[model samples]
Target: MMAPEDAALNGHETDKISVLIIDDDSQVCRFLSKIFTGMGYSVSHELTLTQGISHIFSGRVDILFLDVNLPDGNGLEAINTIRHHPSPPEIIVITADDNVDGAEIAMKSKAWDYIAKTGSSKNFRFALERAVEYRRQKKASLSRNDIRREGIVGESRGILKCLEKVAVAAHSDIPVLVTGETGTGKELFSRAIHACSPRCSEPFVVVDCAALPEHLVESTIFGHTRGAFTGADRDRTGLMKIADRGTLFLDEVGELPLEIQKKFLRAIQEKKFRPLGSKTEIHSNFRLICATHRDLEDLIKKEKFREDLFYRIVSLTLHLPPLKDRGEDVAGLALNHMKNQHGANLKNGCIMSRPFMEELQIYDWPGNVRELFNTLDRVCAEAGEGATLFPHHLPEHIRAFNIRHRYAVRQTETPDPETGSFEGPLVPSEPLPPFKDHMEKNKAEYLGHLVAVTQGDIKACCRISGLSRGHLYRLMQQYDIKNNADS
Candidate 1:
């Protein structure tokens, strides 16, 4: 038997494809295995249906040739168990008894193709080639969706790992639970996952679980029949049915009432639910992706959330780090948003001075990406006409927040080589020299602050600081500050 890892890598190799053979006839397994092996393919064969299912879950097979009538049991019995896997290998039924009903059942359960065992090697080879081609196309479609929405742009190690997991989980129909502080772009990530999934063309529905009333939660998610409740005048489909064959994003999912948790669990487990006051169950296929800013484990411990539901919905969990923790991404995000928002205004776009960018990078964004966008918008709006971005464009809160961070950073007081004590230039405790001796120092600090506050518009900085244009140039030269603040 080929190793699982070796078989998985077969898709990339020329003249190789991972094939799993399932048949009660030892001669048939040997015949197919020999034929496939001669074609430079990696093949695994099992005489029993149970072992075939086990090998499929082993991640060693790309394609399965299952016998419809297994000695142990019928292939239809194992369809549900196979579909439950994160990445179920593609299956092609091979049976001596050819029936339209069996083929329909196999296809409905997501089998790739169904072929009768006519004992023809040529026909088997053709079926194998077709399955490979279909899987290849499916993989390509998934790749295109991943690059869209600029999935979680960041350089931080923590965020990158989260993105890697998202990519792996996207290929599966498993439920995902995303947790983070408020404004952490949980919704953005959820949308990206859905877009990159096989159901990309379908609707990506969102439910604000926090906004729904406790009594109306069931009606909102699971719909209601006509005359089911006091206000129910007509039949309605819930988010689950409406988002059928797509994705359902439950934002602030922790806010869902304890009583509703039980119903939600059943809906997810069976992928079918009855509308309120309805006797018949409605079927809907949707990928569940839930987000919450609250600690769910704590809620579960406190008897506020169902532990069973939590496990079901949390097949994969992604905990996003706050914007403050994303280090260098802050400045990159600002520039990206600025370009995206003010493309035509690029010529007048506030060229972020290095000092201002540095300050923006260091400040903690409590509101995360949302706060960053708001701050950038404020800065762009407040800038003078024909002006580029500057510090003055930012809101008072952000400016003050940055200033506090700067003060805190300088509090450490890095040592200077020229001085015996750990006193450095720009240290918080040290006083700047008088005008004559340290004129350059004074000029640099004053002009730097002016540029940072005004967003690097030399003219605006000169106007606000009451310094002449010529004086600004002279000051820049004296302080060794770059004059291209408008760049």
Candidate 2:
């Protein structure tokens, strides 16, 4: 390592900025290397793309000078590979070819700059300075913008109501149940709620219930004492204890086994629990936020869920809608997606053609906002400068989607906010459907279908079907789905 004083004197020191040069031409590499070295920039040169990739992983390279036409592989291929690495180095394409097409593709792939190999050394130096300056500004913005979230963009009434609920829930220690379809930003909502809560400074932990192994569920959640199990080599803290005085987000909470649920419920209710193999109890304080796409009511009916636990945890609920319902908010959300994928500097710089917007607006995003964001990110990555993003810019799967529900409106059978249990006195239908008596006839069928598709996961069913858990419970009572006492 260079001494501190020496490093400061040599402005081009590796500690200041590391540059990796990839070019098949030896003379060009040698010439640029001399120029950068004279300027005090620590530089490494690779005559092949393969060696360049190895150098990227082997050393700390801040930026890449990649030749578009390499001996073994194309620069675009290298760019794609580099992007998958952590803290990917910025790339500047150096090509001798006068092909604007190649330069356009390079820009779309997020190259910092594109310069012909025949360009003057002065031109190369200028491009290098510009790229480095741009990188510095972007890095600063990223640090400054840390407080803002990239996903979950919306300000429409429906979205605003959901945000209000989340904010209110964050203020209390009450366990909040977030119900939303897959890819509807439940995790993002959980993070936002945590950020707003008093425990914001503390660690915010997430328990992926669905991904936890069945046998290890107890140890994972409650932790274990040393020598408690065959693999217990050391004492470990459970997620609940680790999240003490913070927030614990239980994602896919419905997937938690009943045995685990029993213990988890006790922890939530008392904020104290004994770890496995330990006689003494440990105390914990965490604001619990449980999110799931399952129907808790149906699960309770089937005895697969604990009713007392449900009542205790679900003091408040926030249901997020699928992207399809949010009117013109789609366009605004799409633009935000573009900005995140590119950068703040690229906002409103590229326009999505009207045809593209029309297609996007009409499509039923089954995966919700997440799918939309991913699609736009990919499109921007492939779209060149001055490029008008038409429908073709979208992935083939999205463009080829049959789109049967483009004009279809959701049909709601139950009242908008289905409140009250089956025990409550019935309110007669305002004057019924054309089928008269059959208006209330198929209620059980609808509930059964919802419950089945969700695999008895009540919360998930409620989110996808757009029905409240309370409403689901009433429907179950009327349908006579047998109750499972074990739950």
lDDT of 1 by residue, 289-374 (tens): 99999888888889988888888877677779998888779888877876677444443445666666776887788889888877
Q: Give the Cα lDDT of each candidate.
A: 0.78, 0.76
Against the true structure, candidate 1 reaches a TM-score of: 0.60
TM-score of each model, in listed order: 0.60, 0.51
- lDDT by residue for model 2 (1-487), tens: 2224323433433236678899999999999999877866778899999999988987678878999888899987678899877768889899989989988998899888898888899987887777777776675455333333446677777786676566556656777888889988898988988887789999999999999999888888888899998989999999988999899899999898999899898898889999999998999899999999988888988998888788777777778898888856889888776666655334435668888888898777898888887777656545644456766566645654523243122222224445632332335457545532453454566666666677788766555444467976877888775434215
Candidate 2, lDDT over the whole model: 0.76
Question: Which candidate leads the pack in lDDT?
Answer: 1
User: Where is the poorest 10-residue window by lDDT in model 2?
Assistant: 406-415
RMSD of each: 12.7, 22.6
